[model samples]
Target: MLKSILLFSLICLTLLTSKAQSVQWASKVMSFSSEYSDPLLGKEYRAIHILGRPSKYPKFSATPSAWQSLTPDNPGGEFIIVSFDTAKVVKQVAIFENFGAGSITRVDALDENNKLYLLKEFNAGYAQANGQITRIRLANPTSFKVKSIKITMNSLRVSGYSQLDAVVISDGDSPIEDRIKLEVDPNAYLVKENLGTAINSKFNEICPVVSPDGKKLYFTRWKHPDNLGANKNQDIWVSNLKDKKQWEKATLFPAPINNEENNAVCGISPNGKTMLLNNVYGKDGQMEKGVSLSFLLRTGEWSFPKPIRIQNFKNKSEYSEYTLAPNGKVLLMTTEMKDSYGGKDIYVSFLKSDDTWTEPKNIGAAVNTGESESTPFIAPDGQTMYFSSSGHVGYGNNDIFLTRRLDDSWLNWSIPENVGPVVNTNQWDGYFTVSAQGDYAYFSSVENSMGAEDIYRIKIPEKVKPQTLVQVSGQVINQLSKLAIPAKILVKSRVSSDTMQIDYDPYLGDFSFMWPTKKPFYMEIRAKGFVTRRENFDFRDQAKYFESVQLLGLVPIEMNKQYKVPNLSFIQSKSEISKESYPALDEIVLILQENEGLHLLVEGHTDNQGDWDENLKLSLERANQVKSYLISKGISVNRIDTKGWGGTKPLNTSTLEEKRRLNRRVEFSFFVVQ
Candidate 1:
């Protein structure tokens, strides 16, 4: 009876769990087309390839000239809604062309009061005859707050531009959401954000990954005033939110997890048990900021960092900055591969079941180029990949790009769309991360910053999001030469040599390291032309301005002679040297030159490579070789006494090889006081 009751209870739990997985958020429309076919395969591949298109495209009809409205005033104008608890959070509306022509003259986004928030006027006289997706941004949009949005277009009156065709609308959750929306989405989701106790002294935080139970939040804070000491920089910080509505101010995460150095976090796994961070603990006990990053994992109250294996390290070089997937199994970081798309491509390493990292593979040509691609953020669905790219066609420098996984590949990308006017500016914008639910995004920028660089929180307009990360950095330059040598730098445990290890960029000579505020670690760097540098750092107890410049150069090997001479003795009182002393003949010649005008008795000794008489004869011959070399170097023949003793002197007696090798050596002593 007890067993039956337990089985029933387990079944009840299964049903409850399965019911929770039914919830899902609407996905954005992404498409592509092959209107311009391959010039090489015309007749063989006749059908036009379909680029991903919105579901609202009209059905093809036999009548090519059917009457359809394309203006914003048209009832079917393109629109999409982000919903929470069956209510609208925000709506993104598109109205240009679905299957026809459209030259957009002016685009405006309106709120409930019909007030304009975005008024973009464009002269698209060169718009193609093919359909295009027009984006609109909405404000304060909530699960029920955002009512509706409109898109207006003006048709060009010239033959150069195509005629405006139709408009369409969709209903779902916002393309981007926040912690609250994500938790309430399909499944048992938990998304956390920054809640500060202080207002503006120095409030910087991001990448808040919550545990599956939704009790803890792990994040990173940089340049906070409390963290400003003689060596303080960036460190991992954490907080807990009790209940769904209450959040506490963050505190320095536990010890053995942090060091007196800079630690920046990049990605966190769903369980919150492990996360990836970049750390720069210099060999001189200094924390490096802005260019060296590595990975770390958390266990109980302690978080430890271990360097990526087989990553090359020289005398002093840097290579640690990277991103992590939600599962903690896919690592996306910058590296130099021979066939790289460009500057720094985002390569991925999958964690195999055997606990070893798979060989890193590049994301390939579709999303990468000869330009820099970095800071990859993979959404929970494991399909929507967000990253920053500089070479892809976009509106500004280093624009953020989004791509959908098509079957097994990611070639089907939305024609790189700018995050519109609100999120993008003329300056640099990269290094961005998002909540699991796809609502809110965190990024670092100087646009409206209070200092050199500050982190910012943005409630994205429903249709777009900023790039995944804003690169925070400085570079390593030669102190004496002031020129950068793309060297490889390393960070390891001075105690066990098993902790975090990473390599530096050979191309840029830069590094980006992130870590937790839990443990103290030792940093060491080695390169081809410099001495190994060492430093100690504790994140749990940090210092301020954790920055340093390491000056290093090649170390030369020193040659001196408090040199050990061979045990040259007579064999059983016989005066002769062993044969093994021949190798030391060169040293006797060196001794004569080093001490000019000095005379020497070349004594050879043997512990017993053979019997007494045989050892003595061999030692004699060995001693003569020394006398000959000295004479060859222009030393006076009468100033040298070549003598040998075999089996008479012993350094050690366990074996003949060791004793003979030691005793059958050439020695130079005072034959005549010089």
Candidate 2:
């Protein structure tokens, strides 16, 4: 069974005096009879996890790192002993059951000097449906000073493992309630700011999707006169970032963008040429139940939004949402399918080779709970994802949290971290968007409102913002003509299998990659009649917030033309290849493998600083190594040749290290083998 959210949250306390005292949570987990095994939270339900405050929702958890029994019963007896730092004369004990509500059968207080006092023995009824705290009222306070509390639970009454998030003991017979507060890192909490009257009216504005380039803001407005639904339903609106500071006056999207139904923007491409809009808008202005795509026409008008196909697409919930990946190859949506974990779980559907969406798959327990998870947005950096979930521990209602995609598998995600209470209120909070800058983030909130849930912005706290990444941007250029060429770039990461393919505008010849600076990556830039140029990029050592600019030059694959290998590097003054250079070499092997008749000569060169004799020998060794490695991959030896020009060839005569590094490279020359 899927271990779910909170059930019973447990805490023990003793009355100090007639004066009302603060509630005390379990300060330490002394021992547990048994524990459940849950790999979803990326951790075990250790007894130590039960110490301190409750970190999950109200429902009983198989885990949110809470203590769950191995079976409903712990053979000898199922119980956990928790202690507080200070002992007090106690009266009432309140148990917080996040999961398996009312499963706790008994409560015992441990006094100083070794006396265990009975608090109350519960009947073990599954009272609450989700997570609820039950209070054990006592007529008289304890006479002795109590330092610890013991909880005994029965798994039989609860169905499965009863999860415990925390236990609270209060003094003076007051009710003990441990409210959840996100622990934002010090100095890492962003101050939320309202977007003001220019964008927000007394109506409603929600679901803000920031453009990848960070210049435009797309959102949904409700009950506004400009809305196409005649102020009856929601419509999509947009605002431009004027001078990088203020947002220009909001304007409702003209026809095709705003329809009679609930219209909104789910995703947008970096160039703002294509958008994944909510629902399919037909020619007659009526809408369907699925998502659609609209293209920006050359005339600066949006084309009609047409429905996109998703195999077996079904949403049980009335509300459905989606966000397109920066590359447009992946899409995330919130829906309830037959296999949904609960009310609404976040699912992913990939854009297939045939242009149809594959069936949506559950993203797993890491992000979804028995509750709802919605309004997903992937930052332009590609890995960081922000969404609102009631399943994870947060303030009341829905709260926005950020989690990163760990690997190529959408299932592997870092534990979702709350975005803090600044922007997330006790009310509904969702629709988070970030740009390539990874600095500022925007969301919608009902508080500090112009009317409805107004749009808000915050300087992303460094702790919760997308990891610092370099925005690799440039245009494809012809090596011979020195002119821009419309091109396509297939970017592959050295560490992840997630390959993002992007196209440069045919007119501008420009493309960009919002790549994490911590990882090494290489890209294949291809255009008609041109040799696919492979360039390696590693900005791992670059400081935070540092973005790089590069010009990718491509050459026509013609006779006697030599193209330099990119991202390939050898250890300083050595012929041995750095492991980082393997991917670049593999690219060459791939090109050759694709063209069976292609033969190649690998030439190695050294910087002018190196001694001629030593550089000559070192360069030759490097070229031979490349050839040998290729042969190991089953390439024919007769089809390969090698040479070295130590300091004899220089891309430039500059003395700076940045420029000097250009001369230290391997170059590829191709010939058609008869």
CA lDDT, candidate 1, residue 473? 25
lDDT computed for candidate 1: 0.43
The stretch of ten residues in a row with the least summed lDDT in candidate 2 is 1-10
What candidate 2 gets wrong by more than 4 Å, as runs, is 1-95, 98-120, 123-190, 229-232, 297-299, 544-547, 560-674
Computed on alpha carbons, the lDDT of every model, listed in order, comes to 0.43, 0.75
Steric overlap count per candidate = 116, 34
Over 584-605, each residue of candidate 1 has an lDDT whose tens digit, in order, gives 4444554455555556676666
Report the Cα RMSD per candidate. 22.2, 9.3
lDDT of 2 by residue, 604-669 (tens): 988878588998987888889889989988899999999999889988899888888778788888
Give the poorly placed runs of model 1, Cα more than 4 Å off: 1-219, 223-225, 241-247, 280-299, 310-320, 393-395, 407-417, 459-674
